[model samples]
Target: MSLELESASVEQTQEIAQQIARLVEPGDVILLNGDLGAGKTHFTQGLAAGLETPTVPTSPTFNIMFVYEGGRLPLYHFDLYRLEDADELEDIDYYGTIEGDGVSVVEWADKFEDAQPDECLAITIRILPDQTRVLSLEPYGGHFEDIVAAIA
Candidate 1:
């Protein structure tokens, strides 16, 4: 199953993010694919809220990943936009971190399309004219599919 939401404002987009965030649990991977200023981080803010604690920081464009603890689950936020080599993932313990602690949310995760992920939820945000936006989601694997079905 899938969901397409028309967001009228940035807050609505964050609300959408929060809704999905609430459904997330540990051992989950979320790939947020979209262009810059496309509300990916805005949605992530909502996820932070769902984590039951919130955070504000610049994008991890150079830092790679930032781990926020003290939520219902640990939230690992990764922005892979600056990565030049795929092997660098090993240095960061990429896939290994997905199931070990809290949920892993990767912005610009399309780089890992070949390596996809187990139980990964892919969210694609598209911008339109008139300040409107489209949010598309595909939840893969058993647990993530259950997340989709539950939302449906």
Candidate 2:
């Protein structure tokens, strides 16, 4: 399933994220695709809010990943933007992370498509000339089809 949503402001973008977060389950993988300054981190912050995480969310660009607890489920946030290849994924135990008892959101996931699970939710954010954002959600398998349908 596929969906297209428009967010005219940062708050709207985050609100949309929260709506999706409400439906997340453990072991779910969310792939975020967009260029720099596309509000990926902001969306993540919204997810954290919906998950009831106490810690504030931040971009994992330099650290590669960050773990947030104190929520309904833990959040394993990953930023693969700086990685050279999927080989680096092993260093971070990428597969293991996503398989854990929490939800995983990967930024710059387009870089390592092969490493992504077949049943993940992929969100692509496009910036328009008016500074609005167009978020396109694509579900790779039946697991995410319901989510896309509900959020759409």
Candidate 3:
């Protein structure tokens, strides 16, 4: 199923994501796809906050991934923007990490199809001519369907 929502400001975008974060469970995978400066990291910051992580989250564009613990569950934030190939997933143990404990939120997920999880909440953010953000959420599996419904 799918749901689309609009955000007039950065905080609104984060608020929308925070709703999802509240309902997230360990093993939940959220794949984020958006152009540069589209607020993917901003959404993640809200997610970390909802998960109760201590520090604010930053874009993992260079490091590829960052794990935030001490929250309700660990937050595994990843950025595939700098990756050239999907095979590089192994370098970061992408599968092992996402399949392990905690929730995984991957930015630039559209860049590598193979990096996507079998079941996940896929979010696409589009910037309108007025600079508003349109976030579309599509769930790929049963577990995520309920999440979508709850957030919708």
Pairs clashing in candidate 3?
Answer: none
**Which 10 consecutive residues of model 1 have the lowest summed lDDT?**
50-59
Give TM per candidate. 0.92, 0.98, 0.97
Q: Which is the leading candidate under TM-score? A: 2
Better of 2 and 3 by TM-score: 2
What is the lDDT ranking, best to worst?
A: 2, 3, 1
lDDT of 3 by residue, 15-127 (tens): 98889988988899999999999999999998998888998999999899999999899999999999898889999999999998899999999988866788999999999
Whichever of 1 and 3 has more lDDT, that candidate is: 3
lDDT of each: 0.81, 0.94, 0.92
Backbone clash pairs for candidate 1 read: none
Better of 1 and 2 by lDDT: 2
Off by over 4 Å in 3: none
lDDT of 1 by residue, 1-152 (tens): 77677898888988877777788877888899988888887887778887876565357878999888887888888898888788888889887887677888899999877656856899999998776888888878877778777765
Clashes of each: 0, 0, 0
lDDT at residue 26 of model 1 (Cα atoms): 78
Candidate 2 structure quality by residue, lDDT tens digits, 18-108: 9988999999999999999998999999999999999989999999999999999999999999999888999999999999899999999
